[model samples]
Target: MSKHLPLRDAVLSWLEYAGSLSPKSHSIVMLMLQPHWEDVVMAVAAVAPRDEHPDLYAKVKGDWMLDHRTLLVESGLAEAAQLIAQGVSVPVSDVADSFVTFCTGQARVPERWLLLNATFPQRTRIALGRHTLQTFTADELRQTVPAPALNGLHPWSLDLDLIAGAPFLHVPDPSRTVTRRPTWFDITGPRAEAQHWQALLPLMLWDNELLRVDSVFTVQHGRRFDLHPPAVPTTIRVYPGSQGREEEVEVRDTGEFHVRPIHLSALTAFCTAITKKIDAITAGLTHTRRVPKLRARRLERAGRHVVAAYQRTYDDYGIWEVEADELYLDYVIALEALLISPDDGKDEGIASRIRSRAAALFLTPTERERTEALVRRAYDARSRYVHGDKIKEQSEHEKLEELRALRLLTLQIILRWLVLTPADTGDLAPLLDAAAQGTGREQHIDRPLHAFFATTSPRSRPADIVLT
Candidate 1:
């Protein structure tokens, strides 16, 4: 009975307060994102890994006041942390009305699930984040992230993977190197949903240095530097085929394959938690008006370079997808494209160029410590992997962890760079160089990326825990 009464008022109130700040408050921010839609799903026996705000630990579960406040904050109706602490499945605007009758056709829906109000249709589905697992072939991650969502767009999960017995869209040449067909996480979902799938796409090409600020580099409990035989990645492959075969899948229009993707439960858990923050950051205009407006001016100029980097990171195989060593090198190349300038002195090698410039762009004086050693060690590991030296040292799964850190850092840079400075025609390297010269915490990227790779990072939780 109370669901629809207040949201319209809240938007109006925000507008009224914003009007005092600017004469053209309504025209301020627009998140410009066009999502690359591909089918997405990954599940490990449906582990419901959820996040509980530290605040939630102080209160009881299902507290009405807290849920109301969380909903308000996520919808931008109230001033609060933007992350969704509760895993309530929000509806997408495109399919919101699709379930109206099913929602209210029956009495009160047995108890507490999406209550209907007098203005039910008017307020059907405005918030969108599917609280579940997303699975897809790691290779199908060729598309760009954050499918564009304009004013008031919300989407419900359709779960096309659940479509039973859809015809097999298979690779005709079984010998052409692909052990399995690519099942992509379709960017078909609305903004919030697209952001999640997009972030995960590049991890195959992606580290864990438990970043600590004071030390500049803390030795984590990671053998990430140790050379272990390469892992047969389970992060994105749904069917679990031969090693490196899926990476060989070409990015052609192979039509849609209604197949189960390589589902990495660990990856699903990591991405599920991190994406809430990602959605909050990428929405440009609320510029969470990312209108939620991403500044497209720079994207227009550097679009070629950035998209190519993405292509190399996710689409190119021989360089990135073959082995952990090649994957590391591919990351180096990709990072260089976005951060380096033509003017960068050749005396500074590309790796140092990438490390220093990326630090300028992403790290703070305090945050740099965590990744400082990581970059150095990753380069060392690159040598071992590229040259195929087998170390008898123990395998701590450090290679995978290192990629986790790098991939996440890379993802943040790409997303933030998209919207941060649209009007500037100059290369990102100089501005970041200038920011480095300046002294202020605000000068750093709004959210410090160093913490994401820290051992304390929320993304490192065990995959089996059912937080929800």
Candidate 2:
């Protein structure tokens, strides 16, 4: 068996590296460097800590300094020593081995390192961007690093795959009304086979997944990228009948789902796609700074005061149990839908009043045009009673035609808002022109718009085909 280095030396060198990376805001970045008893001895010798070394120092008490490297970095002296005595200390000499043992073992060391490595770059970005107006979000975290081994690091040591596969969950703070720290998780296997699970726990508790960036606001063809894990069957199916006969189908799928592993490169690509979309959406609008009359002056004023806080609630705390809480958002969507499809047979009181107010506040210019046209048609329908002129009967046919026309046009306008940004004016102009022409391009023009409303529709294909 190879002799182990002294624990002091190993701690010193590891501490030096970690100390170098610490920011002013934080204390020592104590990465618990673990090594076997024999290797620990060699490392301690290499580090050579000197401070009145006792003859019986073999059982040195709590965390001891190995100052050969100007700092100390080692596993918890008390716990690690106990672990080594138990013969479960992973026997390895390299950093990679240390990392793997940290991950696979029940010890907390692996989870800490995984978090440190993954978040170090993000913290660096935040520190740099702090001086600028730019902000960082999980969606904006798409840095392309060179292959790790090429940097002369451990081969097969660092699990960058775990970092890439992780899903970010951000929950909004209900009272503070801003996003809290995002939680990241990697559902890579049945039971989260590594310390990576601890790294993801915070975000999951906050229900971060439900606070997803609106796919609507992302790159036009992004959802089409479809970089999802394959469908793990919750139930399996079996055919019992002979070939060409009336077959009976039996389903037996009953396992926790797992998908083919997504590569780190693919994760990079996905983030890049979202970044591009955010870039497009905010591009021209930011430059032009043309705050449209999407809302009334008073409402706009109120929105300015409240929207930040409103957005914060979703951004920080998020809608917990989204399927259950999403109905809270339906008020806004239903209002928009009702603008196009008014309940003519039903009597309106407070509901219509509130809907009309929302329409004024939320409807864009094109949307307002379509909505006003619908209102005019409804007045003529007589099926809907409204204060109108005597010519309502004569305009009945025109009103009905206008109803469908405005509904379709309204849908397209909203879809455009969803799919393209004013910054993408160059790419989107042609599409808008095609839509405006309303000729043979109706289906094509309507595709993106229809797709948004038809997300649950089987006829729905990918967003890329409809948008691009």
Candidate 3:
């Protein structure tokens, strides 16, 4: 066979390039490969060292070639390509050529012979096609892994534990913050500015639905790329309506240009933190604070009903272990805070402000009445129980039960309000779901959500805008 000059030059160039990309020596050669070429390079690299670059044995060990290939094939890129080709107007020749070139020298492998066998001029011709590779969005990335995309591309998968309760994108700038931006500098950070154009062009070319999967593909070339994706943990300010309705008032652009892989634990942690806070806030609103006395037995029985309702709601949202009594105490504290919030001007009274804001945000006539009636009953029952008053008949227990039901109803209402407020900007609903398996929502929710929040910015004093 004719000597593989292109393959040789490409391999040497790639090794030098890969070394430059990392902060440490002995970096993965395939790291330089772009999403379109990642697998092809990995596969070539896996086999190449066995013969081509025996001198580089200390740098790589490759018994795991099959394992890596399985990862790519499992990504479903091959299948996705088949589907797209049916309707794609692009000719197949362009794709075949891209694939051949990618599989050859650009594969980022250290092995020589493996590289030679993999790169074929004929194969390159066969792989050529006009169709561009498939891509995905950050919102569509999920915890559970779905099947891979066609042509060996796969949506990014992460360990769930990495993201559980961990914050997404670290706020303000989702892209790595390189430096502070001056007002004169229209573009903020380096990556942020680059991604605006990077994400924009691909986004315009693809349908919104396609972006949600957020998969990565690699040609044999050493270039990595993000599929069309929006910034993660998209925060939106919403206006909560009574009856658990949230109307999108504004959405904030996270300024995320590329899809960065995150740990599953981070995703979970974020969910847990927000949910726990919600649970804490809701539980606080449910119970009253009167100490038990001579009528303790009667009060305890009423408390059980309240506890059961609280637990039930928690269970629906995958929360347990929050004891009935603790939840009851929280409910009482929240109720008192809500009642006194309008007058609680104390700087440290954050709970009061939250309550006051909630009251102002959503207390339609019907909802207002419901809240008042429940608070009234809880207050009276608490007073009677604490004062050592005589226990009444069955009617009192019935009244307590009514209060429990109303309390649960109110908690749900409050959560809706809490999630919509700009103060709750970290509540990342759409981005969190992106980590979930399966196809995700069609359009990006971040912009609309941010827009929702921006609407209220005008109401704030100009001095408080926090503009940089």
RMSD of each: 24.2, 17.2, 22.2
lDDT (Cα) of model 1? 0.31
Q: Write candidate 3's Cα lDDT for 163-251 as tens digits.
A: 22221211112222221111212243322212222112122111111111111111111212222223122346779877999887433
**Global CA lDDT computed for model 3:** 0.30
Best by TM-score: 1
Candidate order (TM-score): 1, 2, 3
Choose the strongest candidate by lDDT. 1
Q: Over 4 Å off in model 2, which ranges?
A: 1-78, 87-275, 283-288, 292-416, 424-468
Instruction: For candidate 2, write residues 61-90 as lDDT tens digits.
Output: 565543321121222232222223334432
Clashes of 3: 98
Tell me how many clashing residue pairs each candidate has.
58, 28, 98
Candidate 1 lDDT tens digits, 1-468: 244223323333333343233222222131101011000001100111123222111245653222322222222322111111122222233122211211222111111011000111111122223322222222221110011111112232122222112111111121121111121222333222122233333231122212100000000010000101121111232343587443433211212111122323433344444444344433433432221233322222232333233334332121243444555555554455556655666774767655665565544454455545566666666667768885224334554556656655654555444334323233556666665666543444433333334322333322222232
Q: Which ten residues in a row have the lowest lDDT in candidate 2?
A: 215-224
Model 1 ranges with Cα > 4 A deviation: 1-322, 362-366, 383-396, 439-468
